[model samples]
Target: MPGIRKSLLQLVFSGTSMRRWNDKMRPMELMEVDKQAHKMIMAWMLYMLNGSDLDRKDFIDLGDKIVLGGMYDYLYRLVITDIKPPVFYQIKANPAHYQQLTQWVLEQLKPRLQSLGDPFWKGMREYYADGASRDDLASRILDAAHLLASQWEFHLIKDLNPKDEEMDEIEANFIQGIEGFQDLIGVRELMQGNKASLGRFAQLCGQLRFQQRWSQTPRIPETAVLGHMFIVACYGYFFTLMVGGCKARRVNNFFAGLFHDVPELLTRDIISPVKSSVKRIGDLIKEYEFKELDSKIFRTLEQGGYFELSRRLKYFLGVDVGSEFASTICLEGDTREVEWDQLQTIYNNDDCDPKDGFMLKICDDLAAFIEAYTATRNGITNDQLQQALWKIRKKYQQVSLTETMHIGGLLADFD
Candidate 1:
């Protein structure tokens, strides 16, 4: 009964409607509750942003004090219950109720909306009408935050126009490097590749740990996948030091990590749960994905004639871009028809050692888990880390227990 009541409350607040309540409640009470709920949701969102670094227990403590706790439970139920919008729209048929709800939402959001700049306000204004789904909300939020943070980066850049020609050239090379890849990846428009914008992306990537799922730990901030690539590249360098320091191996490791997930540009980050769930439905989805990748994502990159970009990525990683080694390095796991032993024999025959690539995988998982731990510290409960660790441990049994323990300890420290 409590759960049902709570669900009804959430439906009312989330612009959904209940038939029974519409007929029974007084207009004044409905309007008052709706207004309060709107304010409460906004306040909770702000709190989540501000106290994002609080630990799980502390976050729960704060959330309990705020309206977010209720909102969280409510949204979760709505998602699980698979409630239909038509039911809500029926309640919206009540003209007074509809007007009151709209007015309340607008009034509550007004201050925050006005505080944002014109560009941001324009985007927000179009967001609802544009049919922006709930999934796109996170990306849009990150984009908006990046836009806001760019003002500071711009000011910082203005102070750094060096007079030295060589220095200028070096700076130009960095810009060119980023732009070159941007075009190749077809993310040029999305990222803009400007110093301020790149800086914002990097910062947000670190802040949000976008590479990671949500956690009860505090999040780092919103970070672009490009930023994660950079971190992985750096980790690859360190990984080389830990193992025998081979120049070629190090280069390969870095490049592999850099371009490993570039296809995500086309697919967006397909969350693992969704991917695994679709497994039961067989290869239909995979076939569709492959077609989508070839037609939409890969075509865009190919049009940029960025084969050289691919070469550079492979060159730095010391692998043949067209080789099976390259495929394994770029794509996680083998999708081929070969058996495990056969695949191993193929790698052995080709002399394409899996060591460096495997290490890079470890680094990737480490960075991701660390990001999750940080998110959990911030006030998010992210069970994804535990799930991932379990999965990886099972998947990479060949990985030394010592190495696994070391990586696990490193991640656990963040907790």
Candidate 2:
């Protein structure tokens, strides 16, 4: 696990300057964070659109390739930088650096691309040769990349006062852009013109798009909201083989891991140490999450045939959407393996655990470990993060209760 994370951290987002925040009048971030957002959003779209006569294996594979392709498009967009583009801009353009970053991304993604059949490369070669006879799929992918990057501006300025006209305009532009780009992916057709669900989704995007994780720790390069989403999704995919061989189950668990933090989208990412410091306060925070989900997030989307969407998301997240086997998700590790059949039965019954929840927990904790470990590696002398490491290791050693997302080989694999 650590080996995989080390490769990803050092190679995938390896920009020359990744310092989180400073006094520059204009902030510039590499598109790595937005790449994460685009991938997750695409996963979600495919998740919603699955079972429409598509083989589950093919569907998952195609979704991965599409997201990676969109990321490639994101890199190519950096082939040129404007002093003031509508979305991302460069006060100082660095073409060589951008090219280097693009090559790094290509190297990381090459394996995934090669695994897909050869026609994808054929499309690539033809498009490169003709220059004008580009594939429609590529254009839509570019559109997806732009959508994620453009809306990410919300995350950047989330600290601004909500009443600020700039925020209002940003929100307006996002809403309007989605409305206009319905043709790009035919996504609106999937929504069935349910403006109510779409409206609530826009609000949900705003809620999560700006919410930062690990806020208490002093990070050398601060983590953003969407960047962590990508991490969780990537971890989900990594663990897919460890649990089982069911194709749909693999995909299901991957998404379960993806939305595990979706509740934090509503309630901000509170540190677990703070939550555990006081039992009553922790319980209070959980109660607040339920209340907010009910009042703000869920109710708004419940009527749009998306009531099922709400239920499935909450099931994955272990929120108030209600499942009888929610407690089973908390059951210990190997226990889940033995009772796996029963869990699957319960899953179909909707009174049960997500087939992937237990594995999801492990991957989620692994993500926490990497976040803390990487910060320390980057020379951030943060006691909070240091303690985070000790506490995580200590708890993993002490706990036999449910294997609680801590893998035995994790520290063994650490650098």
Clashing pairs in 2: 362-405
lDDT of 1 by residue, 129-234 (tens): 3222323323323223323233223333333444434444434544553443331222343244233332322232223213432323234343345445544544
TM-score of each: 0.38, 0.62
Q: What ranges in model 1 sit over 4 Å off? A: 1-222, 280-293, 296-305, 311-355, 382-398, 401-415
The superposed Cα distance between candidate 2 and the true structure at residue 305, in angstroms, equals 4.4
